[model samples]
Target: MSDDLLNAQNDLARALVEARLLLPSGVPGLFGRGTVLEDVIERIDALVVRTAEGDGARAERWRFPPILPRALLEKSEYLSAMPQLAGSVHAFDGTVQDHQKLLARVHGGEDYGDLQKQTDVALVPAACYPVYPIVASDGPLREGGRLVDVFSYCFRHEPSPDPARLQSFRMHEYVRIAPDADDARAFRDGWIDRGLLLLRGLGLAAERAPANDPFFGRAGKLLAVNQRDQELKFELVCPITSAEKPTALASANYHQDHFGSLFGIKNADGTTAHTACVGFGVERVAIALFKTHGIDVAAWPVDVRARLWAP
Candidate 1:
């Protein structure tokens, strides 16, 4: 990024801090949201729920903890696909002698990294990861498959000065499990329009375009290219930080049989199911609203306020 763009992002970050919308924790990309910011986020979430209801989507709501079993994450192949962004939990599982050694190192101002051991649980990388296993366990799907509403606090290892790119964030998603790839693709496509409409309803200048995940390594580059070529992913982006390179506030992805095959989710005919999800970055959307309509929610346009805050 150019210096000018960096400065712009920095200025926005400082402005948000000054307005007390974001409480700094002395860590980049990690913040404790102020009450006003939290209120905006909750209102946005409620608006999403209302929109989904208006669309006649009878989605089963599921909420999951921030961490999932490490084995499950491995089974999902997230570590292989985006190892750079994965966050694993670690604990101090040492004997008394080891504890004494750790204490000595701490007192001596030496590194104590070796004292911690990897735990069985890892931070959830996405909101939809936990849904597939439960769906699979419920046995074969019915004719229309299943629609689930899931939300979770997700974690990625990226630490940045850009407030839009948060390390710890909330993702609200609606996942569809279908009997075939065509169904999954169609579901994702429909959500692309819905997502764009929802964001635009909030008075955001949101745009939809083909996109791909930031897979890791050289092999990941090939995977990303294939994803784009297949047009399997689309993002609703807004210029919260910079217009030259907008941030993705929402994404729709068709994960063709990847989760189904791994988790043994099957159709009524025993064929592996296909899956798709539309995810909204809750904090990013709130940030965009604040950036677009100013920090004061009371001052937002009447129509926008009604869309979000009204009954």
Candidate 2:
């Protein structure tokens, strides 16, 4: 990392600490958010709700747990794409003797975590992931297709000092299961515009840019490139901490029947449903708001406050 980049990280850390928006928990990439920060996040969440519920579109609201079935995750091919980021749940399943040995190892400051065994559950990486299988299992979709609003606490095992890049966070997604690729693409495009408008309404200047997922391995590089080249992923970004490299507060993605094929989701015509989703990183948006408009919520501009709080 460049010296300037390091200094920027340090500066942001100091700002977060001084404002008491976050408390360091002796762990990198994991911090306890203060009430003020929570309030900001709640405001952002209200914005998400407005977007999801607006336009007279009926949406099925869903809230998923943090952990999902490991088998489902594997079927989704998430492990192959970004194994480094995935977090698997592990638990102790040994006898009492094993527990005694584990305690002794802990007391001696040895490697005691090996006593745990991998469980069937893995931490959910995205809010929309768990919804695919459930929707698929219900048989073919109705003639016009389905729209879902899903939210979940997601986890990734990436450890970093930057508060914006968290290991555990919440994601709110508006997903569309369409009849064909054209419908999916149209839904994604519409949301990209609306997402930008949503941010602009909050007084955040955001721009749309083609983006790619952080795929793993050599083969995964090709996949990432193809995804970007095909314009499957786009992000609404603004300068939160770094002016040169903006942070993505929202993302719009068209999966092109990938999830539908894997989970056997079919359309009314017996064809695979095309999938698309618009995701908002709730905490990340709050960080952007704090950085752009300052941490004092009461001092924020009247328009932004009214847009978030007013009925």
Candidate 3:
């Protein structure tokens, strides 16, 4: 790693320590402070498992696999969508203190003995960040395109210490890649409705609203605004957290021809694929549900309970 990069990581490590993040004793049951988040995850996991039966190996049901390289991040234009949120991953092999060890060591200014080498690569900011390259390297698909159930345990460096805003969470995605624009748009729309159905089933008040990623710089700012106005990106937000503020639980992103063009992902005849993804922040939804339905999972409405537990 470059000296500059190493310094940046060390600085970030220090900051995380200051923030009471970088939990080494293992993240508490805190993110799931109430049992409702865990229960919601149970529902989300069941849904993911059902979705994954057809996803081949990339499915979260099988196993959480090694995330693809950072190079793919460039292809998917994720840097433009969420540059500030992306996690930069690297390893520590040198004799000096590494970022992995830093997580545990910073607590008392003392190192954990027998610290193991961190072979695991970058921190994941979002679950969808891993899927594009895997599809790219798996060779070209048939003209019809492919759909996959991609999900993961993701992490983010929060700008603030809001319990509602966690530093780590589970993310779920129903991603579609099709040879034509219409199919991708259709898939994006399909998930939007499904998300609303889930919300309604839970008796939570949520609506689809235009949203943009936290992109960096002037061009990114304009791009976000344009995207929002055009309704290129939309969020499923619940107005339960506060009377004036709604919590966003899911997102539908229409990537027009972005990923296909960047990664040369095309059909058998070499037509570029149009890509779209539906993203669900599992914990966020659970939090929203908790606030909406109260902390007692057992007391949740019979209809919502059935939907959550339904096959």
Candidate 4:
């Protein structure tokens, strides 16, 4: 590469490092043992599964692979919600001949293969996108649409100095659907209190307030204002690092018929569906828990500590 190109690449790498936000991946993201992060992940996943129990809602195994359609993103208003936060889906597509050649070279550990681009797909910015397609493909929804619990590894483009605000994060989202606008709104409204209750049970000092999407441009500003004023969304938050303020650890949102209309999701009678979601940021909540309980998990409040490790 030319000197200018080399310098540009260096700058980009440096910029990424500065954005601790993307540190979602580990120096060893697979951390185990008595680490604060490990404890948090365990309790959080348990809560999600336990919360799902007795409900007819579905539960799928969790894993991460970045792949989804561009169309679905548009329908969900994801791009408009946070344009820069979306991560690009990538693949390595090589010709048959190229593959054979690379295989031959690697046979001797030569490791000389060009990583040319394959197909372009969008990175899963949220857990619910893939689920939406799965639900919609069955044609219009049956009866009351559907309610699903999904968890996904998501990516954002920002870099936060705080490792907790990583560029990549795990999100656990519960989506509710209904044929009527009132039903959907009720579902969204219900989660606000429930989410706060869960937070308190976990021993965090949490509160609810209207929130924004970090959208861009003048239109985004106006959209945010409208959403806040209309109380279409709310956040469950508590201080993660400092007592001065708090971060949004989770959100309850009402998408109305926006997604249902776009993706052709319909009711049993075939009318458009109404959608709502309550999302949990597993890592961010972990961060909050650590701050609330201290790095020393053993020393946490008796009830909270027992509940966390209880059988």
TM for every model, in the order presented, reads 0.97, 0.96, 0.75, 0.77
Mind giving the per-residue lDDT tens digits that candidate 4 earns over 185-294? 88777778777877899889899978857887887898898888878889988865444446788898898777788778887786888888888888777766765675
Against the unseen true structure, what C-alpha lDDT does each candidate score? 0.91, 0.88, 0.66, 0.70
In model 2, pairs of residues that clash are none
Per-residue error (Å), model 1, residue 81 = 1.3
Tens-digit per-residue lDDT, 93-174, candidate 3: 5455555566668676885543545344556666665666667777776656777776777766554333445666778877
User: What clash pairs does model 3 have?
Assistant: 89-122
Best by lDDT: 1
Question: How far in Å is the alpha carbon of 48 misplaced in model 4?
Answer: 2.9
Residue 182 lDDT in candidate 1? 92
Q: How many backbone collisions does model 4 have? A: 6
Between candidates 2 and 3, name the one with more favorable TM-score. 2
Query: Candidate 1, residue 109: CA error in Å?
Result: 5.0
Model 3, poorest ten-residue lDDT window? Answer: 24-33
Error of 4 at 31 (Å): 9.5
Q: Estimate candidate 2's alpha-carbon lDDT, on a 0 to 1 scale.
A: 0.88
The regions of model 1 sitting more than 4 angstroms off are: 55-57, 107-110
Q: How should the candidates be ordered by TM-score, best one leading?
A: 1, 2, 4, 3
